[model samples]
Target: MDNPTAGIDRAAPVVARHELTIRAPATAVWGLLTDVPAWPSWQPDIVSARARTPLTPGATFHWRTAALDIASTVYAMEAPRLILWGGPAQGIVAVHQWTLTSSGPAATLVTTEESWDGAPVRADAANIRQALDDSLAQWLGHLKTAAEKPR
Candidate 1:
């Protein structure tokens, strides 16, 4: 399969990827993924998220996290399957992508990958990579917990 991060600079210093199976239908998981405004409620790293326009290609959203405030544009969207978004933040260029697959009637396998490039990232590649790993892991855990909870 072609790498989703292929478009990102191969020289990127920090890259993180994580995946988990969620015991919830893809429809349920997709809803949570696309609802940008509700991110802060479950995503501990996100302080706030707002997207004035629908999450279509070229649409932009503002996100605030403990590390930086970033304005990202949605680059692609494939319904309950995939979404990709990225932009420059705090002097770093980043691209993030999520993929979903229906493992069964009530289970979805989710994967997320991110790449960071720029002088800032290169200056502290090890620490940045570790941080991204931790962040992505936490995000997947939170999503799994939320998705699997009895509703």
Candidate 2:
């Protein structure tokens, strides 16, 4: 859309971004980041997740995070680099994307962005924006923790 996101709604009511540098390679970070079904093990909010083997565009995945059941399609993806996915849930149409870039010999700069629209978001833009920001911030923190841990 208008923002840098791959497939987010161009005119979403709220958009949020959060990023951090992880002390690990992008490949290592990507491996932990993209495996949908394995999310619950590392992501505390992700109660459950399941997706087709080898994520690809148009492949839909179902996941529960923050007690919200979400089914998002793989709108776009690039191996070990970026993924964009989202769909309607609980009266909110949300789009989320993750980007990974190598920052140094063994470091990765991770960026996550998301957009939310629909009646609920439109009605409570400020609160929704903060929620989205907080959610992304938490997700990024988890990713960094998981990715940086010694494996």
Candidate 3:
């Protein structure tokens, strides 16, 4: 799944935010988010992924897509609440969060927020912004479909 062809946006620092609501419980979403190995099934952008070590602070993981190669290290992991991490320098530093709230008797509101802080592939802020915006949108769409699926 190594995306040797994946374009890297190395312009100025860019920030992207993507959010989605899931009908599933926070716990369900948490399970999927924390389990790095399961990402390929739902996250279409990531063709394959695996953690080089367990998912703990400082543990590294490698993920691949048709257009990108992502290497990340877990910064924080608090089940049913938050999971944050970033990638190697020149790579996207991402904070992936899952917030679950009780809606009523048999339902939960699962909200996911993904943000990235990094340099753009070029100097044009507009172009970088466009890429970030598009990337986040695609990511959120993939996450929404995956998180909403039956476990």
lDDT of 1 by residue, 1-151 (tens): 1343244444577888889999999999998888999998888889999999889988999999866999988888889899888888988888888899999999999999888988898899999999988988999999998888898
lDDT of 3: 0.61
TM-score of each: 0.92, 0.92, 0.71
Task: Show where candidate 2 strays beyond 4 Å.
Answer: 1-6
Error of 2 at 97 (Å): 1.1
Clashes of each: 0, 0, 8
By how many angstroms RMSD does model 2 differ from the true structure? Answer: 2.1
> How much does candidate 2 score in TM-score?
0.92
For candidate 3, report its TM-score.
0.71
Where's the lowest-lDDT run of ten residues in candidate 3?
1-10
Per-residue lDDT for 80-128 in model 3, tens only? 6666665543544555444556555334555444444445433555676
Question: Arrange candidates by lDDT, highest first: which order?
Answer: 1, 2, 3
- Record all residue pairs in model 2 with backbone atoms less than 3 Å apart, i.e. clashing: none
lDDT of model 3 at position 44: 74
Task: Name the lDDT of candidate 2.
Answer: 0.86
Candidate 3: residue 111 Cα off by (Å): 5.2
